[model samples]
Target: MRKVLITGAAGFLGSHLCDRFIKEGFHVIGMDNLITGDIKNIEHLFKLKQFEFYNHDVTKFVHVPGKLDYILHFASPASPIDYLKIPIQTLKVGSLGTHNLLGLAKEKGSRILIASTSEVYGDPLVHPQSEEYYGNVNTIGPRGVYDEAKRFQESITMAYHTYHGLDTRIARIFNTYGPRMRLNDGRVVPAFIGQALRGENLTIFGNGLQTRSFCYIDDQVEGIYKLLFSDYVYPVNIGNPDEITIKEFAEEVVRLTGTDQKVIYKPLPTDDPLQRQPDISKAKEILGWEPKIGRSEGMKLTLDYFKAFSKEELRKSEHRDFV
Candidate 1:
């Protein structure tokens, strides 16, 4: 069986990747620090002899025995709430963590994929962001910790690819939503659903006009899977291009949950992107990948998953202890 090392294997995206690889008959070595990742996301694979896990921080060093065919570097605090609370750790994961993985990949002659984000576009000046568009970013902003981390991650990955002749792929992931997402992660989808389920009003920031394009988790995983195998070395945007405003999405959530929750507005967080939509031309042209799941279909599945949470679970997840 082909062996692969997946960092952040317990995260929403990473867990799904683990499942996909396991399905494809790969011996998967999963690693995470459990800082923002929940082991529960990948606990199902514990029974499988092919799935091995390590509860270690990638920022220090990464050592995996045997041959590694691929390495997916997905270890980083991905959300605003998590990164803001632990800025240094977030930076280290993207920079130092990524560096360690690149070295490991070099040593093992493994193909490595780095998880880049749309946030690298940074409140993008371009509508429907394409991979070529250099982003307009506030380096000193609160959100820079996460954004810059991703940017640096991409740069280093490319450097290794050119300098060391490492096989590398970079997926510029956009906003994705689905099962296993943390309610209190402060991302829009889970936050809205959590509020509605808790009988609380859904909160909107920045006048609700700020737009985002949400890709479903399954589609996202598929895109990443395809990218990993494809020979493309540059970044490819993996996200649904269907864009919606924050206010409109809140209404959709209320309808989906069959709740009579009100929508409340709050000040927009600093450096929040007003518009985010991916131009997936490269993904389509190269990997022949585009999101097959529409928002309605995807949202229903996601909502159903969150609806399974007990009231106590919902209550406790109402606020994440950032500390």
Candidate 2:
């Protein structure tokens, strides 16, 4: 059995990756600091004989014994609320955390995949962002903490691949949604769902005309898996290409929840991207991967997840309101 190390193992995407790898019969080593990630996401995996959990922060040195075949560095503060709340940690995890993981991969002679984001295409100048597009980003803006960190992470990761001839893959993920997402993470989908379920007004920043493409979690994980095992070293865009305006998305959520609540518009946050979509031609050509879930179906699945969270769970953590 191949041994794989996954950082941010307790996170939404990390936990899902763990489940996928374990189901494939890989011996999985899960690592996280529990800073923003909750243990509840991967608690069930602890019972598996092939799964091991490490409560270690990846920004520090990683010391896993034995030969490792693969490493998936998914450790970073992904959500806006998360990065804004812990900006330094976000930067450190993306910078130092990626460095530490690359070093481990070098020592273990393992292939590594780093999770890059569409945020690198910050407030993009292009409509449907392709990997070749040099993004229009404000490095000194409020959201720069996360955007620049990811930019740096990708740079250093590629440098290692070039300088040391280390095998590496970069997946520039777009907006992904499904179960296990924090309700109060300030992402539009979960926030709207939580508000609708609680009979509260759904908040929409700006005119709500800004567009975003939502990829289901399963599709996102599948793309990552393909990129990890494939020999593609260039960055691959992994996300759904179906674009929808925020207003349309809000209406869909209201309709799905059967809620009478209305959307309340708020002033747009600083540096919020006005338009975002991914061009997945590279993923399709290189990895033969494309998102399989439709928006309506994915939203319904996410709403059902939010509905499953108990009222008591919501009361404990404001973030739990969405599930």
On residues 168-257, what C-alpha lDDT tens digit does candidate 1 reach at each position? 999999999999999999999999999999999888886999899999999999999999999999999999999999989999999999
Best by TM-score: 1
Worst ten-residue run, lDDT, model 2? Answer: 314-323
For residues 1-323, write the lDDT of model 2, one tens digit per residue: 89999999998899999999998999999999998788999999888889999999999999999989999999998998888889999999999999999999999999999999999999998989999998988998878999999999999999999999999999999999999998888787888887887778878889989999999999999999999988899899999999999999889888899988988887888889999899999999999999999988888888888889898765543553221
Q: After aligning candidate 1 to the native by TM-score, how far in Å is the CA of 207 from where it should be? A: 0.6
| TM-score for each predicted model, relative to the true structure | 0.98, 0.97
TM for candidate 2 is 0.97
Q: Which stretches of candidate 1 lie over 4 Å from their true place?
A: 320-323
The CA lDDT at 12 in model 1 is 95
Clashing pairs for predicted structure model 1, backbone only: none
